[model samples]
Target: MKGTVLVTGASGFVGRFLCMRLISESWNVRGTLLESESPSCLADKVEPVTVEPLGRNTPWTHALTGVDTIIHLAARVHIMDDHAADPMTEFRTVNVDGTAQLA
Candidate 1:
């Protein structure tokens, strides 16, 4: 094991695939999901961790502990509808703010 690799949004499509590939390579994997989501599906494949948004009072210190590398795949997807809420804000919140905190 090359230390623990932290993967945010490990329950998602791309995240799942990345995790599986890492597992096959014999790397120690740690996955982070929102507290509301279930990570049991990856139980045998990798270690699952529940993390909340940065401003939601979620403790990130524990999640980052011993993490040699971090692959952040979590983000708020863009809506096709023009009437949807501002995409810039959503992108900033997840892509910018979230990524900054993790880094």
Candidate 2:
């Protein structure tokens, strides 16, 4: 085992590839997915954990157990035509506060 690594957004394009690479490198990969998302999309050997609405208050204790490293790929991606009343705050909530909480 290279080490235990927790990868957020493991079903996303970049995340899928990263998980594959880590798997090939012999790391124990734990992936975070949405409650409705399926773990079948991830690479073999990945341990999937369900988490939703990434934010400061998002519960992470269950996912953080024995994790040697965390590669945070979960974020509120920028939309070209974002319709949110406060887009910046939304982004900050997930990207900033959520990441901070995870750390």
Candidate 3:
């Protein structure tokens, strides 16, 4: 086995593909899901874990267990037409602060 890897946003586009590739490479894969249910897109070998509301306060201890590497793909994106009063803050909360907390 290549070792266990934790993939954040495993249900997302790129994440799905990456998880498949990692599985094929003989790595033990653990995938984070925003929802409680497992995603149909995820491969059978990928262990699914819930880590909703990706942000600074997201609880990650369960997801990080036994993980040799972390591939962080989760982020707030595609808000070009956002009408929020402070879109940057939302982005920073998830993209910057969330990532910082994860690291």
User: For this target, which candidate reaches the highest lDDT against the unseen true structure?
Assistant: 2
What would the TM-scores of all predictions be?
Answer: 0.81, 0.89, 0.88
* Residue pairs with backbone overlap in model 1: none
lDDT of 3 by residue, 49-82 (tens): 8886778898899999899999999889997789
The C-alpha local distance difference test score for the whole of candidate 2 amounts to 0.91
RMSD list, candidates in order:
2.7, 1.5, 1.8
Error of 3 at 86 (Å): 2.1
Ranking by TM-score: 2, 3, 1
lDDT of 1 by residue, 1-103 (tens): 7667988878877888999989888889999877777778553578888788743234689888888999888877745674637768766777777777776
Tens digit of per-residue lDDT, candidate 2, span 60-103: 99998999999999888858899989999999999999989898
